[model samples]
Target: MGIKRLRYWLSSLTGQVIMVALFALVLIQLVGIQIYRMEREATLGLVNSRFTLQRLVSVTRLLNQSPPALHDEILRASRSETLHLRLETSQPLPDERSARFEHIVRSKLDYPEPLAIHISAEHNPRRVHRPPWMHPHHRPPHHRHPPRPDIRLQGGIELADGRWLNFTSLSDREVPGWSAKAVLSFILLAALLTGLMIWLLQRTTRPLKELAQQAERLGRGDKAEPIAETGPREIRDTLTAFNRMQNRLDRFVSDRTRMLAAISHDLRTPITTLQLRCEFLPDGEDKQKIQQGLKRMEQMLNATLQFAREDGLSEPIRNLDLPSLLQSLCDDLQDNGHDVTLCEPAAVIYRGRPSALRRALQNLLDNGVKYGGKVQVRLATTPEQVQIQIRDFGPGIPEAQQEEVFKPFTRLDSARNLEDGSIGLGLAIARTLIHQHGGTLLLGNHPQGGLLVRITLPH
Candidate 1:
């Protein structure tokens, strides 16, 4: 698929719904986890800070009560892995960012200058080399470990004798990491929800698909069975309306055909009565004119009745080889001494009313031979439809009357009269039959002097 089409599919209802749901789910999970992590870090930091303050106060009190001679040893004993303590005469500058923390610590300890509080990552211990004057067996350099990037808190507190006691400690972190179990749960939940959404979409759109199929059949004049009203309320209502419309179309066609047939049948009796009245008159030009008029009326009535019967035709559709049908039709004309030529087409299997389609082709072929002399027939298939071209070697129809000939009871030559065996329904009936099969029958004048009848049947 191309990018544009894929993007269009993603913009559909199911795609949007699934995308929104998944986005919301991920957003909620990430936000919730982040909030919990922040709360956990805040609680841990508070407790650790209070505990470190107490330890600092204890060490300071012990140093104050002890003698000056024991100060160095006391400070050395207080030092440990987590806490590094040192004494300096000059006080280090206090960190501006930790002003509130400094005030709290100074108030708790009392009798202190401004305290220094700052946060940073701890650094590795410095490496040292022995001096050249030292003995050959010199003391080994201090052992060093890889530096850690964990948070380290440091502070400076001034004692009563104006000595600064600086201390460093690593921040205690107890926040748990996101686990594999949580990840698996999220994946499984998203999958389940996506599957449920797809199922629901299929159920909702299935009825709509059926409605579209039936609509196509209806356009082709096929009496499709009514679809079962299913799906959501809107879909059910649409199907119901479509079914009612189909029923009404069927009724309308049937009623019109029946009324036409009835009128034509009733007119035949009057035409017969007129024929009897003309026969009783004396043999003269007027008597002959009356008889001829009655005969024309009878011919017109028969043609009308036949046209009505075809209008109400309810033939069953069947699968047939279209090329074979055309070949047989041409062969029949040839056997009957008609000048018919056929260009054999490739095999094409099509589904339609075979009888109706045959009659339509026959009409076109008959017109070409009877009115225009020799007929040339050609059938070919395109990707989308089947085309049949029929041309004759006689005076072609004029441009103005090309479309008019397709109308019922329309004659190309007014002087030809009804005796020529044409009630002008041949083109009309052929076009009607083709239309009923969702095809087209077009009339045009051939450049080489003959009428061209082109028919296209969709695959």
Candidate 2:
């Protein structure tokens, strides 16, 4: 689970950018440290070489002037961990001379001519302590770093007394390197940079996130206030365009609704006048048929206008107890002699238009009760959504007509009857209301024997 979350985080743009920057910073620090060590070693070597030359020259001059009895005291005083001074009988010199060492010695020494000298180097491997974790016999070859070899400069310089002065000068590889501060500082720096990067990215992207949420609400046909034009110029321009489009759409719907209302109001006078005229007609079968047709026309017109006016979008949303609402709905139906039962559900607080949700639930329940005899409502909740299930007991809708029945003015031959004063708009209006609330309504045939209506709302 941790690895999955890490992968998900790394896949984002902000995460990738931060990772790259951190990687570059670490790489540069490492390279700088390495270069620093190399330069330090070179500087130490130069200082040590000059000190070695001065000591050799000083010891040679003092021994050349001092008596044989005092020479031993001088050599003993000069003896130390890094140098060894001794006087020996004539010894065979090397055929080849170290030209660099010879030149350096000559430049520093003012000794007379025929200054014969031979320089050689010897290497001795350093001993390293074994860590407690590593076994003696089972030691791994690549487990630890290899020890450095110690370099000792072996040289013989002839003096005026016809004897050779031997010296061994050991180079100190431990040049005491100094680097960055405590380990805590590095850790703190990395953490500080990571947090700052995340904050900047979130701040820069916050406006875009709001834009997406508002656009989603708009797509669901819910009314939203105009959003602030924030972020970069391109993003601000996009937000401005979205606000304009929403305003224009709202105006268009308002105008169309007003026009429909005016036409409906004008038609009411003529319909009433015709009804009064038919009142004086003879009591004939044709006259009764005409009157019934006009009445049906008036009913259809009224239903259409009611649908237009009571679309439920104009109602403001608020928090309400959904379980209480369901219990009340079921209690009312039961009081009216309908066989509807609601299981006692846990309290669910939700935010939405109360009137719209109530109307939608009523339509689904009515349709279920009208076709099927008994109705049962159940509620379930999950982390992501809330679901309401309505089941009935009579024959359910055919599989093919399930989706077809949701269309406005669509009625099936079997259960959708005009005798119930259903203008084939209940399910359509219910679905529209659900969608506006960012919810879904679906119809399916229950395995037992009736239609099942399922409503799911995002939480």
Candidate 3:
């Protein structure tokens, strides 16, 4: 397939819409997972920060007491609503180390400045006066303080009243490195799978569309063969069905055509024999009548055989000058003294089964001369189509009866009276052959008081 057509199929609104919807769904799912992970991380951060604060408060209280043993009773007594204190006999760090230590603890509790709490000495706490420009609505600084930096505990929480507590440690990065890699890999794999599905779906649909086009051509009576059966199961089955239909139709037409040709062929020998025997009759008025009847019978048989030829059997197409052929036919009829005239005599080359087309045209002219008392043949052409008209001057067939007259053996009363030997197969066979040639034959009443038969052929 050409790139243009393939793109057209893929971009068809239905397929494009489906693909877009699926891709959007996958994207939303990925985004949702990421959002959930971020929210979980924030929750864990709060828990870890609160736990660190409580641990510092407990160890600082323990050092202030300078206990012989870090007794559980002393730790319990120091506990308060704002802080939990722990006493231990550990030497105080040097001033520089202690100062650096405080910086790290303050950094760990890095809230916005307004939410920060100050740690102060238990006795004679350093004066903390509000700044002169502080907002009137702000409250005084609270007594409780955050944990010192040096202490480390598994987890803890500090309260405003100097109470503290601890809890087990936990990492907020719940999704591990391997898990994140796996998830990303899955998304890429899913994208690849989705692309493959789109390609396969489009490939399957293309042949089905082609098959539908072929079936339409067949319905229009143009020769169209079955497509190659290859695709998904549904498309393959549809192609198989189309092939089967073609086979059945071909067989049916072939059988009927053969039967008709056989029956018509069998009648010819008898017709010829009858003509020969009619000649042996005594030369009287009765013999003359009988000979005329035999000749008409022979004509009907010939017409039938011509109709059968429109079936499976056909001559190979070749290029021929249409104008020359028509002129020749006109000349032969004129020599026979039928008023047959050619409107246009220029050479026109066309590809066709020449013999079949010639016979069809000749039959129309014959009917014109036989009943219309005269024949006028006119030919015209345009870029897209060709038209031939044969008009007769006899009493024309009624408009309603024109259609019936085109059926085999359907002789109109007027037609029968005009030609006493009318078998009514002439127009029928003409129509069949014209249709086989991808043309149409129509009957209309001439404005000049006669029958006008028009044949239109596509270029």
Best by TM-score: 2
Residue-wise lDDT of candidate 1 within 1-459, one digit each (tens)?
699787986888778888998999999999999898888866766676666667777888787788878887887677644455777786555343365556666677675344444323223322223222222433334625422313445667777776877776544343566789999999999999899988998898888879988887787777878999999999999999999998998899889888998898788888888888878899999998888777777888888878777742488778989888888898999999998988777678988888899999999998888877799888888778989999997788777778898899999684223336568998899998899888899888898778889999988
Name every residue pair that clashes in candidate 2: none
Query: How far off is residue 454 in model 1, in Å?
Result: 2.9
Location of the lowest summed lDDT over 10 successive residues in candidate 2: 127-136
Give the higher-lDDT candidate: 1 or 2.
2
Could you estimate the TM-score for every candidate?
0.71, 0.74, 0.49
Select the stronger candidate by lDDT from 2 and 3.
2
lDDT of 3 at 408: 90
lDDT of 2 by residue, 9-96 (tens): 8998788989997898788767877887778756756676567767888888888899989998898777654566778986556545
Off by over 4 Å in 1: 1-100, 103-190, 382-384, 393-395, 398-400, 414-419, 445-449
Clashes of each: 0, 0, 12
Instruction: Score each candidate by Cα lDDT.
Output: 0.76, 0.78, 0.65
Using lDDT as the measure, what is the rank order of every candidate, best first? Answer: 2, 1, 3
Per-candidate alpha-carbon RMSD to the true structure:
7.6, 6.8, 13.9
Candidate 3, residues 234-330, lDDT tens digits: the string is 8799899998998888788779878878887898888889888988888999999888887887777777776665641346656877898899898
Ranking by TM-score: 2, 1, 3
